[model samples]
Target: MNAEAARTPLFDEHVALGAQMTEFAGYLMPMQYIGIKQEHLAVREGCGIFDLCHMAQLRVFGTSAFDFLQYLMTNDLSRLSVPGMAQYTLICDDDAGIIDDVIVYRTGEIEYLLVANAINRRVVFDWANMIRDRWSTHQPCGESAPRQGIDLEIVDETDRTGLIALQGPLAIPLVEQMMPEGADIPTRFKILATTIGPTPVLLSRTGYTGEDGVEIFTHASNTAAIWRYLLSFPEISPCGLGSRDTLRLEMGYHLYGSDMDRGVDPISARLGWICPADKPDFVGSDAIRRIREQEDHRVLVFFTADDAIPRPGMSLSANGVEIGHVASGTYSPSLCVGIASGYVPTGYSRPGQKLDLQVRRKQVSVVVVDPPFVQGTSL
Candidate 1:
């Protein structure tokens, strides 16, 4: 690991467990503990815990926070009219290109917690401040400026905070053991403020894997203690980023850099569902609308390889002619097959469509399929 890479609070705990550490988003993180396959299956059949302290956390609040975010994000903030609700939204540029895909949690009447990908921490934070400044000074031609009072503030809280995820079939049951009596576990896409044993945390029922789980946000200092306490459960496995990638790939979840990026629009990435057509004008609404109406655009699709494991940047060919490239790919532990996602022209993006993946010197046949490659899990 690079000495310049930062370490999370649970870094020592991962080292104690004999994990293989690697550099990710300028952080030295665990790539695997026992093994990727074993850890992947553990989350599918039982429970697994992941250290997500590297993810970026931003706090936005004040009198005009609601209106500020309404213009900044692509999703309708009205869905989270009350506290304790969470919505997955995309932060895009004026060209409709995705800056980052984030989850916004309404923690109070005028407060929000935005969680973004670690690699995009700087970009997303800078973008937020730029928009906030623009809204505060630039007044529209005829309409009243939403930032008249300039009461909004955006703060990066990633270093001072810690994030952990407990996921699987037994995730909820295991988490309930630490909660106070009569305290209800939050449902999917909901957040609750409570204490786990002695540590106060903001628990949200959301996860990257297609499993029933909760993400706990607590003070950075309490991360190690909480991680160790959860490990006391005999069935809980300490998972690493290797298994995390595979689990999400099986669920067809979009990864920030690989699946989508600054050059890709949500509509082309199959994430248009998050952008409501009835919402008020936002930064990228016009460009996204144009992309939606255009007929000549590439579409993201999921596919399965016969025997070879595809990887990012591998070529996708039809009739021996190169077309697109794989965005994300890995072997699925639950399904025991190679699964991948890539972008291809809309004409050849349908399920059952055949494409050849160039794996090194060999060409492997692949079939496009709908997502959730390995179903029947505890979602």
Candidate 2:
């Protein structure tokens, strides 16, 4: 493996457990530990830990930090005023197409941490810099921390932060077992600054699995010890990218590049809630405004089927006319059905909307339905 290819601290552990490794986002991460099916089952039945340290962690500070984020992002961070709160925001290009999506965690009054997907690190950072530069010369970052640049001078990306995602039904219990006394796994969507054994870890009740889980961010120096400690939990198992992808797709959630991209806006992605009428002009406000007024087409409707499974870029047709195409899909272990989400005409967004997936030489019968094909033990 190339040293600069980037790796999570659990590289050795994943190899020891016999993971199938693959190159994703320039990282030699595990594609699957046992197998995608088995690992997917484990997350549904028990719990799983994923090494997510390769994802980018960006810090924006200085006096204009809040204002900078507002100008670039769609969601209003002002509503996320309380400490230990995390809100999902979409970064849009000038055309209102999604440049990327990130979660902004307000860690302090003037300091904010942005969690961006690994593939679009440079794109997001450059956008952040443009916002800072356009707003004013008053940089919001702390003077002491040199803006260790990736694609921008104002964005200070810590050289290292080890993040572990403890997911599945038993995630809360497993994480609590490894945490200190005051580390309360209190409710979903809340972030707590706590410790795992002796290491300071930021534990957040958020996950992509459509399960009740916690994502713990800690310093890289302590990752080895924490990995060993967390593995000791009877309910917590180790999972890799293969299972993670299937799990997220099973819930009808969007993946960054594959499901959403620069060509699509939130309305077409079934993410209309991200845009509010009263919110100030974000990057893509004008483009989205026209899309909304036109109501030209509907976003992808999620669905499940025992037969006729769909994959990304596959054709979705109605009668003899091609109406839409699959954006994301997977074989759901829990639902025992093939599930998918894709774009269709505005008239077909409702349930029981009949459509056909032109898979191979055959047209498979499919009907639109709701998501979370399987129920989570918690909400």
Candidate 3:
């Protein structure tokens, strides 16, 4: 790809560590540090440091930050008051189509931080920019009155920060051992600001791997040194994107590009709660408004199989009748079974129902099951 290829901050470390590299979301990232299966187990049994520098970060600050975000996002920002507390939200259009999913965190009294998916980074930025502009224009003006302008700012910290996701049951203990000042790491979803050795890192008690873990964000320059230190802990292992995908999939978490997109509504994605009606307006409120007023027939179903891995786009049939196609499918390491999540006929989405998954040109036995194929106490 020549110079057109973009390298992440850990590109050198990944190569030196003999990681299998791949292009993801326009960035060259390590697909696996050792191997997908081995690394997948590493995070499941122990803990691992993942380079999440490729994700985008935006800062929404000033008095109007809160209200401005509430209008643009689906989740109620009203409940987010405590600093460093983070919650998941969906950005959607009126048609109920999800624009993106983001994590909103209150960094200060009136400031918020939004961490978005890699693929929708640019769209999120532009969306936030448009809201901020509207807020400025609509703000009321009066002397000796509270400032009306919602001072909102979206700062892209993607290039400046490095992220490490330490996931597993042993994550808390492993991170506590890496602290330089002998302070305890945050065990819950709260964010803790501290130094690992001499380098500063913000550890958030959150992860996408459906395990009890911490995802740390730090300066780009200090990533390598901090990564090396984390690896020194006996409980910490190194995980890559391949394992990360499998882990999230096992928990039935939707991957933005695969399980969802502009074409699929949030209801069909089984993420309907992400839409908050209290908000005055958002991108996809109108569509969702109509759907919620009446019973919608869209639903996301979990199909578990024993013989074959359910590949995305595979035909789903009921009594030999084609109904839908698989959106995402993978072998579950934790469950020791093949699992997939996809949109299906609303009538067939019921639990305990049976279906056929055409995997590799062959119909495989499959049964509908509840989400979170693996039980994790983290959530």
Candidate 4:
């Protein structure tokens, strides 16, 4: 690990568990604990815990916060009927290119928290602050202004906070035990602010593994103790990045840099669902609206190979014409087959379409398949 790369407070604990460490998004994190396949199954069948403190957390407050977020994100923030609800959204650039896919949580009437990928955290912060700065320097609109006394406060709370994801069919019950007596688990897409023992925390029923889970956020100093307490449950297995990737990939979830990037528009990635056309204007709304109305020549798709494993950069062809290249691929532990996702000509992206995946020098037969390779028990 590079000397300057930041380590989560659980780094020492990972070493104690004899985890195989790897560098990802500038963090020295565990890639696997016992093994990827075992951990993946544990999460599906029982429960698994992951250290997710590397993800970035930002807080936006003040009277202008809601307006600022509504203008900044693709999903409609007004859909959150009550505080403590969470929305999966995208923050895109001016051209409707996805800068990052993020989750926005309404923590209060005027306060929200945005969670961004670790590698794209700074980019998100810079983009959001730029808008806040512009709004702060301007005067309010005439009598029709949305609100009065508007001010914006943006804070990056990544380093000061620790996060852990407990996911699986049993996650809710396990997490409930850790919460203070009489406290209840939050409903799906909802958040709860409460305490575990003496540690203050925010628990959200959101996860990347396509499973029922709660992501707990607490003070960085309290992470180690919380981690130990959770692991005391004999059924809770410790998972790492390797299993996390396979699990999410199995669910057809997009990884920030791999599946979508600053260069890829939401329409091409088939992420238009997050960009509701009826929502109030937001960044890239014009471009996204245009893109949505037009047909994209290429679209992302999921395919499976029976005999060959697909890897990123591998080529895809149909009828001897190069169509696209693999974006993300791995041997799916759950399906017991090689599955991949990539951009293919729209004609070849439909389920049951036959395409050839170039694995090294050999052409392997692959068939387009509908995603959620495995149905996740999220609710």
TM-score of each: 0.98, 0.91, 0.93, 0.95
lDDT for predicted candidate 2 compared with the true structure? 0.78
| lDDT, model 4, position 46 | 93
Question: What's model 3's overall lDDT?
Answer: 0.79
Q: Report the C-alpha lDDT of model 4 over 83-122, residue by residue, as the tens digit.
A: 8999999998879889899999999988999999999889
Task: Give the C-alpha miss distance for residue 259 in model 2, angstroms.
Answer: 1.5
Candidate 3 lDDT by residue in tens digits, 1-379? 4456678788898898888888888888888877878777777777777888888888878777777787678887877667878888888765777878888877789888788898888988987787566545443332233435445567888888888888887887766666765686765657868877678888788898888888888888888888887877777777788888898888888899888887878777878777766555565667877776766565789879999889899999999898888888888877788889888868999989999888776788899999888875444
Inter-residue clash pairs, candidate 1: none
Best by TM-score: 1
Candidate 3: clashing residue pairs, number: 7
**Model 2 steric clash pairs:** 61-140, 61-141, 62-140, 62-141, 63-140, 96-284, 300-342
Q: What global local distance difference test value does model 4 have?
A: 0.89
Q: Write the per-residue lDDT of candidate 1 for residues 241-358, one digit (tens) a residue.
A: 9999999999999999999999999999999999897775787989999899999899999999978998999999999889899999999888888999999999889999999999
List the candidates ranked by lDDT, beginning with the highest.
1, 4, 3, 2
lDDT of each: 0.93, 0.78, 0.79, 0.89
